[model samples]
Target: MTPDLADGGAASAAPSPAAAERAARAPLMSVRNVTKVFGRDVVALRGMSLDVRQGDFISLLGPSGCGKSTALRLIAGLSNPTSGRIEWAGGGRTDADLGVVFQEPTLMPWATVAKNVWLPMRLRGKSFASCRADIEDALETVGLKGFEGAYPRELSGGMKMRVSIARAMVTRPKMILMDEPFAALDEITRFKLNNDLLAMRAKLNCTVIFVTHSVFESVFLSDRIVVMAARPGRVIHELNVDEPYPRAEIFRTSAEYAAQCRAASEALNEAMGGAGAGHE
Candidate 1:
């Protein structure tokens, strides 16, 4: 069973000892020296490589125009890398085992939240009645239990994003790929969703590969932050966040967090050009 965090901020559930023991078993998904090039000279990715261990919360972070989204698309099989290969743990190329959330909600306007969340299963040929319990559970997980019957137009921006998350979770995917899933939300809503996402990750035990530009969000949510450089995106730095799960707001205010964020900011600055190029 997953350990639930206590109200006083104690980590009730550290990662399972068995999970720790199997840490090096093999990555659930592996991106091996992947590269993506557009016609003739435009390169999106350049020999990028990373390993996503089972149940890891990995984030791909970089400035605008960096290939963060392209990397995620390559993993999702939505776009093929021009060079290099992405292999699943035991060696496979299909994305049937993954779920993907785009930057936008992309929900069906006519479908109820429940129906929209049920789309993945339905596409897989699963019947609605057969997956009713799973749909309800997913909705509840995203804090949208009572709004399952509501349409997309009736929901607020945050609620719509929750619906998008619920849809991704309903499939019981082995891995989830998120491309700045919360970038469009307001600060308050984004923070709330960030906390909710951490809680959900602890409970679900699924691997996540998220793409974002926010250093603070990357530090708070990732087990490992992969910082990429622009123009033919390549890895410039990889930083491991050693903090425990269910991270608290206090950690956000601590010196350690600031230091790491500063390090990331520096790397990102250098990647963009130099220290004085952009506003940190």
Candidate 2:
């Protein structure tokens, strides 16, 4: 699953055995020399490549102009690369095998929570009645069991995000693409949602490709951080957390987390100096 090779990644130290082992596995999907340009002059991403193995939790970390969201969109098939390819191991697949969660809840305000979660399944030709149990379980999984009948307008921001995540999970997609899903929430709420996300990931046993600008959040939630640079955004470094799952508040305050964050911060600092400016 080793995603970044540019700059040989920014780790001052060696990866843990666990992380190395993980990197050696077969990739579920691979992006080779991907590039996306907004127009004639604006280059969003350039020659970006990465490998995503099954059950991996990867975070694309960088500054605002870095191609993190663009990368996610490519992975979700919501957009296409200017000149590159994304290949899945088992050959071609349908949209049903993928899920996406945007920064905003983006729920249908007119629909109830249950109905919102049922949208994906419905789009695939299943009726609400047919997937009622799956919908209920998805809601409960996100800690919104009793709010099924509630409308988006009636729910809090965190609850609305829960609905969004539930909808993504309901499809049991092999991989979920999340674009700063908790970025707008307050710190306390964001922390809770982070924990909830890890727990739900464990229960669902699905891969996640998350886009975020938060170093601490990425360290706590991701096993691998694909560091990117702007000005024709591209991978600059890749750091592996190597910590086992079920990360908790204790882990948050641990020395390991702080060290990883510092390393990532340093790599990010150098990239912000425009490391990608002269590169294609």
Candidate 3:
């Protein structure tokens, strides 16, 4: 059972450095010294490295143009790195093993929520009759059980986003990569989605790499935040959020949360300030 976050303790408790060392034991994917360049110049990323452990939620946090999305794209194998490597543990994992959620819902205007969610399964040659239960389960997981017949235009912004998420989850991928999926929503909706996201992640036990510019969101969601810098993007700091799962409102308002947010904010500021550059 998932631990109750409402009965909070030190949700942002500081773990020993060795804690990460322990988590690193079952590394799922590693992005090592990867770089990406466009045209003659336009370096999007440089020497970027990150380790994704199984069942961990990691956030790539940074300012705009910091290559957060670029990193996600590289991990999704949508693009090639200019240098370095991306390694997946126990190898031979294909695109079928991944779920991707972009900033926009990107739903089909002509399709129902169920159809949109069914797209992934259908692409894998799964007929509606074959995976109908899985699509419904994914929708229910995202709190949209009764809205399967609804069109994207008929749903609220938050609901549309939920459909997008439902689509991603339908495939039951080993890992999910999200690029600010909730950035477009209002605070209340975003908060609700954040909680639901934790619950879903707990239930799915899938590893996640989320990219966002919101420090608070990153602190609340991530086991570790990979803070990055721009102008040839690279990781500058890594801050661990030792908080427990099912993070509740009490945890959010707690002093521990504030402290973690401050630490992340400071790290982000320093990253934006260019603590170390001169690469690429």
Candidate 4:
């Protein structure tokens, strides 16, 4: 089972035993000295590397054009690194093992929420009749239990994004990649979804790699935060959130959360200021 949330505020300020244990286990995937270059001019990522362990909630935290999304795309096999390799723990695998959610909902406008959630399974050759239960379950998990029949146009912005997340979860993927999915939502909606996402993740026990520019969001949601530099993006710092699962509003308001966010902010600022030097 995933570890429970820390009882004391300070307990979350540093890496916990549970986080260390998880990190020591075999990684689900590793990006080793990866580089993504466009033509001969644009270099998106430079020698970027990270290990995503099972059940980890990792946030690729950085400013715009910091290669956060590029790294995520590489992990999803949506794009290949111009140099270096992305390796799976089990040696080799197919893209089917991943569920990717872009910044936009990108739902089918004409389809019901249920059908939208069912698309992944449907593409995998499962009929709607067969995956009906899974479709409902994914929707319900994202707090859209009674909105299965609602059309995308009928739902609010947050609700539509929830549908997108539900669709990603419908496949029971081993890992999920989210590229700033909540960045466009209002604060209230974002907070609600942040809490909801933790619950959903606990149920699935899947690794999550999220890209974001928000320090608070990254601190609240990630077990590990990898801060990146721009202009040939690379990791400049890595901080362990160490916070427990099922994080509630209280955790968000706690001093521990603030401290972590401050630390993350400082690291990000340092990354932003430094020149894109060689990655050690």
lDDT of 3 by residue, 163-227 (tens): 99888888889999999999999999999999999989988989999999999999889877888
| TM-scores for the candidates | 0.89, 0.92, 0.90, 0.91
Deviation of model 4 at 240, angstroms: 0.5
Candidate 3 runs further than 4 Å off: 1-25, 274-280
lDDT of each: 0.81, 0.87, 0.84, 0.85
- lDDT score for residue 61 of model 1: 85
- Residues 1-280, model 2: lDDT tens digits: 2334332344325666766767676778999999999979799999998999988999999988889999988888888889999899899658888888999999999999999999999998998899999999999999999998999999999999999999999999989999999999999999999999999999998989999999999999998889998887998887778778878889899888887887777777766764444433
Per-residue lDDT of 1-280 in model 1, one digit per residue for the tens?
A: 1111111012113464433543654578778889999899989889998888887888888988789988998888888989898888776744357887878898999999999998999998999999999999999999999997899999999999989988888887888889999999999999999999888877887889999999999988886778888876888777666576779778889876877677667666767767666534
Clashing pairs in 1: none
Clashing pairs in 3: none
Ten-residue stretch with the least lDDT total in model 1: 1-10
Colliding residue pairs in candidate 2: none
Give candidate 2 misplaced runs (Cα > 4 Å): 1-17, 274-280
- Which number leads on TM-score? 2
Ranking by TM-score: 2, 4, 3, 1
Error of 2 at 28 (Å): 0.9
